[model samples]
Target: MDCVDLTTVLAGITLRNPVVTCSGTYGFGEEYADYCPLEALGGITLKGITPLPRLGNSVPRLAETPAGLLNSVGLENPGLEDFLVSYLPKVRKMPTAVIANISGFSLEDYVQMARALQVDSGLAALEVNISCPNVKHGGMHFGTDPHSAEEVIAAVKAVTNLPTIAKLSPNVTDIVEMARAAQRGGADALSLINTLLGMRIDIEQQRPLLANTFGGLSGPAIRPVAVRMVWQVAEAVDLPIIGMGGITTWQDAVEFLLAGATAISIGTGNFVNPQAPLEIIQGIKGYCEKHGLTSVRNLVGLAHKG
Candidate 1:
């Protein structure tokens, strides 16, 4: 307990711990201050930012399955100006590294969002979400094409000098190719696997459960897939990997790190248990101490023997 260290890396950025609250789930960094010590966790990725304020989708945006959740959050956000003026200042006051997650409808849109965030005071980096299905364009629903993925990454990288991470979609047939394309376009790091495309049918209503016929599936159901994708991309790219999917416990976070992920993010789990991230951090520390592991670094990539 006294000698274990949980510090980890994400795109050359060293995190004090491997536990991060995924974007959207944690809201703005300030919202979780009461739930968890802002400085104790690795980092917080702010809700997806857009060029203009969004109202988001209509009613019935979220649905829960047996072991997963379906969502079409529509990337609703307060736009760049409001976030910088209102949110960034408060986030900067916290001791944790604050990451801004940006989404766009086109390459130009992504560029504008990136340019706006590059000058923000408290942000540590920008995570380009190309895998959001709730959007009309530019998200993974459009990023499945390798050319489009590369173009989007290149366009965004051209405008911002901040460390950029391209969040990859799990819906692609060849995840490694998309990861490689992102790197070729100058992605400083990569995060996988954003929810898989899926749908839920309401037998009583005789229609889709979510307002959007098809939503992204996230939670324990997708953990194995996310883990495998992270392993594959870790082997395929030179950049650091921010692994996430259905992680709800410290053991899950440990598995991600073992699979080559530099850091881990908890998404849907946050909705079920607000204290899940804090518990995970404690669990990792306990594991390291009991096993006599001095630093968490020795665990990364331990599962990829090849």
Candidate 2:
């Protein structure tokens, strides 16, 4: 009888739709402007930034696999001041929601960046990259330990005035444990399953393909794992979930929604099909219309019904 309601809100920010572009893939919401209209999608999660500028990993930073891609891009960015001075002003006026992704090797690093960014800076929310290794802790990953994850999230939450989204790492013993830790630390929402730890080697050179040796894996190859994590975490965690990691099509996006993601973010999929989000948005509407569902919310976590 009426158009399907596509709007969805996460972390207090209302999105035009439940589709978002993952950070580190979308370049500050401009690179894809010529291909995908910025206004058509839900939000854009800008590339991850750090307190200081980084050159990122050296050459051979990306490798292609059958159904995926591996990257060791490090956290290369223009640092905090440069982003504030140059980027923030532009993104604030973007048609859709704009989210800032922050990465750090220490709790202080996260806190420092958190202090600088907020709704006033034109960001709808802050996605904390706790998946990064904690250099202050003998190289152990912060997302792997419940205590470390909680402490880091709390520190960032305390300093940042914007909504804090804890981006969980999939390379953990228990995804639920990390989700709970972030909640305990007062996270506003959760982005489930960042890239999984992976690597590739060149036979001729007899060395690792990525200069950093290990890299984060993304794309279709990791879809099943990502969906599983979203399903598991949604069943246990109470916060809104942004499901990602290998969503290349409308079907994949719907799977995440049914698994309980309040929203679905497209990452490596953009590289494969720059227009994927537009296609997905249309497809999702069609799906809702066919099912006689009045809103996208009606479809979320439907699979959990027994």
Candidate 3:
């Protein structure tokens, strides 16, 4: 049986396929291996890690929406030391590309984390989570402003020669400015449409649904918005994009690629169906065959052509 080759590269890191698992969704690549073959995935972004271990958010860290899930997991992970000593060695043995996703409160924190990861030869790349708030700089600063984004990206780039992907946020007036800023700061690739900031009210209980009051919105509800953001940024920059948000099937994946995404990440859908990535891989093959496409790259950015 002929299948569409899902194999693709992101910022020079060769992934086995295009169906990557987003950070903070899959826990770690090891967890998925119990349910399905980890090698089938393009790559896995480990949950947001800090320089020090995090206990994460309080109770009710997760809430469910129509077709997605909201999580304020608070970047829970065992810090860089623990990850290097334990997780990294285990992940290195897996065939899938491994990425270390990092979050920091200040510029120095980001640089420190990058330097540590830089010394590790097993990691395929580093995903700088610049969307997180800068606790020392005052309220909601990083994602909303290009200056903050550049500062964070520049700091990390100075310490690591490894491929760096700047993960941007959707909670901004213009995503292009931020994308360009990250690129200027030396980001090898851009990943976008993180999550739309949202709030859920429980009318029956007369309170908020989540413990954090507001959380990032994901799943099918945000796919269209994600596509638009990816399209807008794709036109504004030359860096490859790792597009994600509400991807559940091959058709959705194709839509993102058509909208200008170089690769797609399966987030909410992975939780609903552990084998979602495999289904998407198969679906993409069928779509390519029916359309007489020799390579999936031919379908990228078809929606924006004038």
Candidate 4:
């Protein structure tokens, strides 16, 4: 197994493996430092941060579904200034790459956040989260519209030298269009299929389950949709993709890689098992060994070979 290389390159950045912790689920990478060795994973995408601090949504922000979880966290974070002053330094010391996820209400907000991150020498890349369904004015609004998504990506790219990844939404009408838009806007990579918009009804109370009335749906139920979107986007664009949505096992991650994702991220799976990423990392290595493969990169888009 030592001969099998799990290392892969994304947007010119080298990753020890392809398993990255999805933003918003892994907190700021510090919460899980004790639970799991942060250095063992490929990368950690810090929780979505904004130019200004956000308190997030009200109570009843989370609901559990049959095979999935619904969350309306509303991009809660300590804001860019505090993160740079306090968290970035600690994140820099970690062995894995630190990818910052940024969300915004306006084009300027994205630009401002990108500019601030430019001076952070510890940062690896910027994941522009335009697909947050929890927010009202921005978030999914920009992601659903191709033109708006392009505008935000272009604006951020103009302000930062760091590699930029445009995270796309599954709630859109045509995921491929959005992917192409992001590529044209100068995104170095793309992360597909942010949680699908969903809602739950409290039958007894006859009201919405979440206080926000709606939230993003994630878990095994959305895996098929996520893979489909990743494959579609991969075929449509030339940029590297970080595919995520309901990936709970190495098999699931491998399915995404075959579907055309250059790498994969663990989201809801993290909540179910803190060691999920590490386990998946080992699983991928084991799988490569079993298949007589020398590198995990060889598995990307293998399903398209036929």
| Per-model CA lDDT versus the true structure | 0.86, 0.90, 0.81, 0.92
What digit string (tens of lDDT, one per residue) describes model 3 on residues 97-121? 8888888777777888899886356
Taking all chains together, each candidate's TM-score versus the true structure is 0.96, 0.97, 0.94, 0.98
| Per-residue lDDT of model 2, residues 1-306, tens digit only | 469999998988999999999998999999999999999989999988988897877878899988999987887789988999999999989999999999887888889999999778889999988874312332137788899889989999898899999999898988999999999999999998788888899999999998888888999999999999999988998999999989989999999999999999999999999999999999999999998999998988999995
Per residue, candidate 4 scores C-alpha lDDT tens digits across 1-306 of 468889999999999999998999999888888877988989999899999999999979999998899999998889999988989888788888999999999999999999988636688999999999999999888898999999999999999999999999999889999999898899999998799999999999999999999999999989999999999887879999999999999999999999999899999999898899988999999998998899999999888887
* Model 4 C-alpha lDDT versus the unseen true structure: 0.92
lDDT of 3: 0.81
Off by over 4 Å in 2: 133-140
Write down the worst ten-residue block by lDDT for model 1: 134-143
Q: Model 4: residues >4 Å from true position, as ranges?
A: none
TM-score of 4: 0.98
Better of 2 and 4 by lDDT: 4
Clash list (residue pairs), candidate 2: none
Residue 230, model 3: lDDT of: 94
